[model samples]
Target chain A: MAMIDSTRRSFVTRIGGGAGAMALLTVVPHPASAETIDLPERESAILEAAFGSSVLTPGKISLDMPILAETGLSVPVTFKVDSPMTEADHVTRIMGFAPGNPEPVLADYQIGPRAGLAEVSTRIRLARTGFVYAAAKLSDGTLWGTKFSIIVTLGACVEDIFDLDWQRDAERRAMRAEARAAAAAE
Target chain B: MATIRISIPETAAKDEIVEIRTLISHPMDNGYNVDARGQRIPRHILHTFIVTYNGVEVFHANLHPAQSTNPYMVFHTVAVETGTLEFTWLDDDGSVFSDTRTITVQ
Candidate 1:
């Protein structure tokens, strides 16, 4: 009985190895041939939450930012949307997101016909080297989006200072000041 | 009160597109950093900024911690009439800092 069991186990192992090799052979040829732009899962989820069920058309948005940043503490960004800025047709909102940051949602701008141009410039903090996305919601309920890739030499948002007690330090300074005042009075 | 700087044309033509720039001084602590003793620093940042032209809301922004220190913004608006433009910045501590500028549209 033991000998028959060992034989069956070996047979199953051989079949499994053969199937795995066949699967690898089939998948190794295609190295992502399609040129479709893919967004990270978190970024896609954010877009879905902002504009539910609306198709994100990748056009009409021009995102301008630096390709390389010396520091992640501040990265300048500018985005513009091609719109007439009329009462009937205009951009209603623009949103910026930094997926590499601790909190992805950077800022959201609300505008209307009063906004003569759908352009904005601001500074944002990035945690690391990654893609920054900008989306615009027009009056017609259509969503337009774009993205820019940036590389950061020094990242931000990581706690740098440690082993320093702010409260105790302040207290000690205050005590020293009081002692000085007492000596001056005497 | 925080220091604020606003730059806009003193006068503009009717229906002209005018660029408005604003800068405010704030720490914008993102709460992710730690103190000298390794204690987490509480987050304090300017959360909202709003601009009203002649008492009508023109542009507003919801800011997050990702905004850099001393937030600066530049945007555009149509000069509909001669009126005051009020810019307000709201802080995380429920404090509001505001400034107003007058523009003449001929």
Candidate 2:
């Protein structure tokens, strides 16, 4: 009992002494390890809307993304789909999606017969550290894709640019709106 | 406003795959930040890119706000003959920037 009491007291003291640590928590409290790797709801919906009744297989795509991106401002990504650029069999389009961004669909590329190539490389910004997906549409109406995760240190999608004052104001506005709605309901 | 640059092999063997690279200059505003006076800055970016080889459509892309300033792209294609490659980038402001290069296939 004494040992447990001592441990609890020490934990409290540690928590109280480290406001800087608390600030860090305000950003991403959950470490990357704690964050499960799963397809986000938005991403799943996008895929469903795109493929409709067709099946989306997970192969024939190569996604090149950095494991760790220091800046969310610009991260390079390259996508390649294995296809013969012939008349009957060719890649029609390649689309990029980021589930965590303010907008999920990042970019779309239309591959025509003249391109003769099925690979594309571009730089994209990220809102937060999250998974990036690339999907390729074939002429035969088949869809193939691949996804990879990236860690961003500095975020780019700044709805309020991390201003605490602005955040407080926004929160207050939201609360007032909620209260008004509840009163109206009553 | 933006300028485009493209790189391709000067010569290639028939049916050989050639790499194409391109770059553009522009500020891709994410439309989320406020200016110095705390006013939100409007977003601007190059939204579309299209590549044509010898009057045939080959590669095209639609960009978004997530793209950084001075966008760069690299792609691959097979060489068939000596032809002109036209690269065009459309801006959000309805402006178009274009460049052309010739690839000689031996």
- For each candidate, the DockQ is 0.35, 0.38
lDDT of 1 by residue, A135-185 (tens): 889999988776677788887775432214557755665686788789999
Q: Name the lDDT value of residue A125 in candidate 2.
A: 85
Q: How well is each residue in A1-186 modelled by candidate 2, as lDDT tens digits?
A: 111233454465458653432211111112334322245677768757765622446776656565677778887776767787788998888888888787777778888555676878778888888777777788898877666767888877655436436678567657867887899999
Judging by DockQ against the true structure, name the best candidate: 2
Please provide, for model 2 over B11-79, each residue's C-alpha lDDT reduced to its tens digit, 9 standing for 90 to 100. 999878888888888887778765664456798888888888897777777888878789888887778
Interface RMSD, prediction 1 = 10.6
Error of 1 at A167 (Å): 24
Candidate 1 TM-score versus the reference: 0.77
True interface contacts reproduced, per candidate: 0.93, 0.78
Alpha-carbon deviation at B28 in model 1, angstroms: 0.6
Runs with alpha carbons beyond 4 Å of true place in candidate 2: A1-41, A44-55, A159-186
Per-residue lDDT value at B1 in model 2: 42
